[model samples]
Target: MARNKFQTLTEQMFYILLALQSPCCGVDCMERVRQMTQGRITLGPGTLYTLLASFEEAGLIAQTALEGRRRIYAMTPAGREMLQGEYARLKAMTADYAAYYREEEKQ
Candidate 1:
């Protein structure tokens, strides 16, 4: 059986994809991730740029230069597909955990 490409995504990759779900520049992307995680998972500038570069290399995202020093990023078709897969996986995991907890409560 062929392995799924999305299985290679680490937590950082998932967060990066989630951040790019909205079209945003680098600074905005970082801030969005921070806000979304309620400041619990703030990414450093170096890590953010590295992840962006990797995403761009994988063709999951594309970068466009904005005015002056801004590079805006948006998800590609591949990125959207990856995000969808991740969402499904997370949904299933959450549902399974919920069921397990419910059963435990009944005990």
Candidate 2:
């Protein structure tokens, strides 16, 4: 099977999608990402906008509204599935690490 373009999301990509759990504009996405991460991750306007464009083009997200110049986006069904898959992948990875550490501690 062919791999999906978004099988694995970057830190920026993941946060951007997460920020759009509710409809949000570009600026809202940036600010929410920062807030959610407690300011650890900051997205520049260029990267965020570019990703938004690509994600929209790819059908991962859909534009829900245009409040003046701001374009608000929401995740499509496909996007939600992709995010869920990524979450599962992350869970598996962490579980493996936990198992490995537990065995090491037993030694």
Candidate 3:
């Protein structure tokens, strides 16, 4: 099924935040996300930039420095909080789904 756009705890956002948990340049962040997902989610430049922009605008992320042509990013407290909230929400959703499926299988 297609993913819902309203879902704030998205894989992309999660991975981005995860990548930023440590200092990372834009390209490194994208690579880290790709590696973490085992190539399942490859973020394009446009999408990555857009997400970064949104995160910065939301005060969740910040660009820390520039190494040559690369822009490094880091997670702020707000970003960490957001990530934690998303993780909790996802965990709850997974548990709910698991319980529902288990019951369904019993029938």
Candidate 4:
């Protein structure tokens, strides 16, 4: 079967949406992702802006304001739903890993 668009999020995509949970501009969004991941993830301007545009186009995020050349964005209800789905998928993967490893250790 053909897969749906965004059925699974890339690491960059996931962090970008997570940062947009609150209204913020592109620069702030990059910083937020960096801080949240403890510098493990850093988004360059090119990747960040491109994903922001895509998300806005998909109706997953909405641009809340424009300040000079800066545009602020926040997650829409659709974005939240997407985020929740990804979170659940990730949680389930971890649970499966734990269960498999536990069984391996028992054997």
Provide the RMSD of all predictions against the true structure, rounded to 1 decimal.
2.8, 1.7, 4.6, 2.3
lDDT of each: 0.81, 0.89, 0.85, 0.91
Q: What's the CA RMSD of model 4 in angstroms? A: 2.3
lDDT of 3 by residue, 10-75 (tens): 788899999999989888999999999999999999999999988887778888998998888999
Which candidate, 1 or 4, has the higher lDDT? 4
Model 1, residue 42: distance off in Å is 0.6
Query: Stretches of candidate 1 above 4 Å error?
Result: 1-8
TM-score (C-alpha) between model 1 and the true structure:
0.83
- Top candidate (lDDT): 4
lDDT of candidate 1 vs native?
0.81
lDDT of 2 at 82: 77
Which parts of model 2 are misplaced by more than 4 Å? 1-3
lDDT of 4 by residue, 1-107 (tens): 10256789999999999999999999999999999999999899999988988888888899999999999999999999999999999999999999999999999
The residue pairs in collision within model 3 are none
lDDT of 1 at 61: 88
- Model 4 spans > 4 angstroms off: 1-3
lDDT per residue as tens, model 2, 56-104:
8878899999999888899988788778888899999999999999999
Clashes of 1: 0
